[model samples]
Target chain A: MTTVAPETVPAAPERAERQRGQPRWWLYGAAGVAAALGIWAILAQMLAGGGGAIQRLASPLAVGEQLASYATDGMVADLRSSLAIFVAGWLGGGILAALVGLLLGRVTLLGRMFLPIIEAIRPVSSIAWVPLSIVWFGFGFSSKVFLVGLAVFLVVIVYAVDGCTRIPGELVRTSTMLGMSPMQRFRNLILPGTLSEVLIGFRVGLMAGWGTVIVAELVAADAGLGAHLMAVQRSYDIAAVMATMLCFAIAGFLMTVVFTWVERRLLPWRLEEQR
Target chain B: MTSKEAEALGKTTRPRTGSRHPLQRIGLPLVGVVLLIATWEVTVWLNDLDSIVMPRPMEVLRALGDLVVSGEFWDDVVVSLTEFGSGYVIGVFAGVVVGVLMAEFSVFRATVHPVVEALRFIVPFAWIPLVILWFGTSLLGKTLLVAYATFFVMVVSAAKAMQQVDPTLTKVGRMLGMSRWRLAFAVQLRAAAPTIASSARAAAAIAWIAVVAAEYVGASAGLGVLIINASTSLQTDVVIAGMVVIGLVGAGVSAVIGWLSRSYLSYV
Candidate 1:
C-alpha cells in the first residue's frame, strides 16, 4: 500500500523522525482506552460521593446498562425514525446537489452569477434556519427533512462545484477537439473525474445531516433519538442522557464505517493514493 | 483548512471564470439579489400574508434598523462574542499543543488517539442538553461546548498537517544539529501553520453555530436567545433580523481568519 488510512497514514515517513526507538503504539492505544474509562469511573464516583447538584453524574457501567435497556420497542422506533430522516435527507440532498453543482460548474456564467448568493447564505447554517423552518412549516416531518436536506445541500454543493470546475483544462479541450457529444463528455469524462471528490463531499455531508438532525429534533419533535435525549435530560436522568449520546456515537461510527466501505469499493485508487 | 475546506471557504470569486467582463460578473449577481427581494415582496403582497407570519423584506430591514438602535442587541452581541473569543482561543491553543504532541511524540499518539477516536463520534452539539443541565445555560458551559467542538477540528487537522510536512525539511534540521524542540518549532510548525490557521477559522465558524445552539436551548442572552424569543413571540421580522446578524458575524469571523493567515503566515 502507498499509504495508510487518514489517521494511520502517519506511520510512514513520520516514523523516521522519531527521537528514539519506535513507540509500541498498539499497547499505548489499549492503555489509553483503559485509562480513559478508569478516569471516567473515578470521576463519577467522586461526584456521587461528594453529593450535591453535581452528584448525578453517571458511571460508565451504569451508562452501558442504560444503553442496553434501551433495546425496547420505543428505542427501536426512535432509531428507525432518526435513521429514516437522515437517509432520506442525505440521499435526496446529495443527489440534488450533485446535479446542481455539476450544472453550475459546467456553465460558467451560471456559477459566476449564483456564487455570490450562495456565499451570502452559506454562513447561515442549517441550525440558524430553525427559526425560518419553524415559521414556515412548524415542527413537522417536512421541516426537519428540509433542515437536514439544506445542510447536506449547502456542504455537498460547494465540494461538487469546486471539484468539477477543477477538472484538467487539457482533458476538456481534448474531449472537445474529438467532437464528443455533451452526453458522452459527461458520461465518460466529467462523471469519472468528479466521482472521488463527490464521494468526499458525501462523507462530509453525512456529518452535516447528522448534526442537523439533533438541532431539528431539539427544536421540536415527538420522537427521535434527539428528542429522547431531551426528555431524559429534563428529568435529570444523567445515565439515560449518556446512553443516548452513546447511541448517537455508535450510529455515527456505523455510518462512517458503511461510507468508508462504499468509498473504498467504488474508488480503490483513492484510498491507496490519498496524501 | 484542508485544501477541500479552503476551497469551500474562499470559493466566492472564481479566477477560472475571470475571462468575462468584470461588470457582468458583478451586475448579474446583484440582479439576482434584486430579483429575489422583488419576488419575496410580491409573494407576500399577493398572498396578503400578515407581517407576523411573513414579514416583507422592507419590514425585516426596518427591524434590523430598530435592532441596531436598541441596547439589548449590543448586549447580546457582547455576550456572544465573549463566549466565541474565549472558546476559540483556548480551544485552538490546547488543540495545537496536544495535536502536535500526538504527531511528534509517539507516546502521546498511542496513548491519546484511541481515546479521541472513542469519543469523536459523539456529536458535540448533543452535549447541549447535558451542558444546560450541568452548567445552567451560563457562559461556562457554552464556552466548554464551543471549545469541545473546536478542539476536535484543530487537533485532527494539526496532527495530520504536522505528520505530513515535507520530510526533507526535518532531515535538514536534524543535520544542522538542531534540538528536537528546535526542529519542531523552526521547521515543523512553520510548515503546518497554514492548515492549522485555516482549520482554526473553520473552527471559529463552528463555534458560532455551537454558541447559537447552546443559547437556543436555554440562555439568558445572545443572538440565539434573540432569535428563539422572537420566533416564539411570532416576531418574524426580529427573528429574520437576528439571522441576518448571525450570518454577517459568521462571515466576518471567516474574513478575520483569512486576513490573519495572510498577515502572520506570509512567511510560508
Candidate 2:
C-alpha cells in the first residue's frame, strides 16, 4: 500500500490533461468502432472472396477445425516432446549463465580479460550455431536443446553480469560497515539484488529459447510444432498451418503471462511500483 | 574452512588487482580459448565421434578455405545480402510511416497497437507457411516474411520513441510561431532521433533473425538453406564453415550499421 510520490509519476500531468480533453467513453467508443470494422472486413473478405484479396486470407473456422483434428493426430505428442526438451535446455542454460556471470562479474581480472571475447561470442546468433548443434547432437532432442541453450545462454549471462556490476557501491560499503563477511554480504545483498535482474533475463531467455527451438525444429527435426507446420505446408493445408501457428502463439503468450505472474508474486516490491 | 570455501571467500577479500599489465589481460583469455578448443578436440577423439558427426576444428578450417575459393559461396552470400537489404528497406519505410501516423492519431494508436502487439507474439517462422501459400515460395514470399517480422518491431519502437519526445520541444516550437505540422515533423521527430537510431540498430538484429527463419522454411539460396543442406548430408565440417560465414556476415553488417549511425547521425 506504499504510494509513489506525485512528482515521481511522469504520466500524471498528461493523464489529467488527456482526461480534460476527452471523455473516457470516447476511447472505448473508438475502440469498439475499430474492432467492429476490422471484424466486418475480415468476415466480408472471407465470405465474399469468390476470387479476391480477402479470399487469400485463410479461413479461421477451418484452421480451428484442423487444429482439433491435429490434436487427435499425434501433434499433442510432438508438442509434449518439444516442451520437455525446452524445459531441460532452458534450465541448463540459466544455471550455466548465472554461474559464468557471477564468476566474471566478481572477478575483476576475469571481467577485463574475457569482456572482449564475450562480446565476440555475444553477437554470434544461435541460428548460426544450428549447423554445429546438428553436427554434434544429430537430429534429436540433443540437437534442439543445444541450439536453444546457445540462444538463451549469452543473453542471460549478459543480463546477470550487468546486474552484478550495477549494484550500488554504497550498499557494499554499508554491509562492510555492519561487519559482514564476504559470503554473508553476497548472500544477503548482492544475490537478492541480482535475483530480480536474473529473473528478467530468464523471462526474455524463455522467449528466445522458444524462437530458437522452432527455427531449429523447422530446419532439421522430424517432430514439434514447426515440423507439424512444415508437413501442413507440403500438403497445401494452410488451415492446419495457421492453426498450429495459433497454438504456438498462444503458448508463447501464456508462458510470458505466467512468468510475469510468478515475478509479481515473488517480487512484491515491483508490484508495489505498479500502483 | 575447506580449501574450496577458502578460495571462494578469498576472491573478494584479497588486495584488489584493479590494474594489470596489458599482456596479462590479453594472455588469460587467450589461454581460456585455447583450452576450450583443446577440450573440444579431445572429447571428440575420445568419444570416437565420426568426422561426419563432429569434425575437428582443422577440418572446419579446411572447409572454410574451400568455400572461400569457390564462387558458389559468394553467390549465396550475395543472394542472402540482396534479400536482407531489399526487405529491410521496405520494412523500415513502412514501419516509420505507420509509427508516425499512430503517434499523431490516438485512434489509430489504440486499435492498431493492440493488433500489432498481438501479432508480435507470433514467431516469424510461423509466417513461412502462410507466405508460401500466398506468394508461392518466391523471393517475394521471403521478402514479405522478412518485412512482416521486421516491420512490427520497428514500428513499435518508433511509435514508442515518438511518444517519448520531449513535450518542451513542441511547446518551444509553438512559442516560436511554428505551425503544428512543422513543429511535429521538425521538433518532435528530431528529438526522437536518438531512440530511432538505437531502435534501427535493434531492428537489424531482428531482421537477421527474420531472414534466417524465412530461408529455413523455403528458400532456393541463403545461409539458412546452406546450413540445412550441409546438416542433412552430415557434412559437419561444411556446416561449421557455414556457421562461421553467417556469424561473420551478421557481425560485419551490425558493425557497419553502428559506425554509419554514429558518424552521420551524431544528433542521434
TM-score of chain B of each: 0.94, 0.87
**What fraction of the native alpha-carbon contacts across the interface, defined at 8 angstroms, is recovered by model 1?**
0.55
Model 1: per-residue Cα lDDT at residue A166 = 86
User: For all the predictions, what are the DockQ values?
Assistant: 0.55, 0.25
Q: How well is each residue in A173-234 modelled by candidate 1, as lDDT tens digits?
A: 89999999989998999988876677888877776789888888887867799999999988
TM-score of each: 0.94, 0.86
Model 1 chain B: weakest 10-residue lDDT segment is B1-10
Minimal lDDT window, size 10, model 2 chain B:
B1-10
**CAPRI grade of model 1:** medium
Clashing pairs in 2: none
Residue range A14-45, candidate 2, lDDT tens digits: 54367457786357546855675568558746
lDDT of each: 0.80, 0.71
Query: DockQ: which candidate is best?
Result: 1
Task: For candidate 2, give the lDDT of residue A118.
Answer: 66
Candidate 2 accuracy as TM-score:
0.86
Model 2: which docking level applies?
A: acceptable
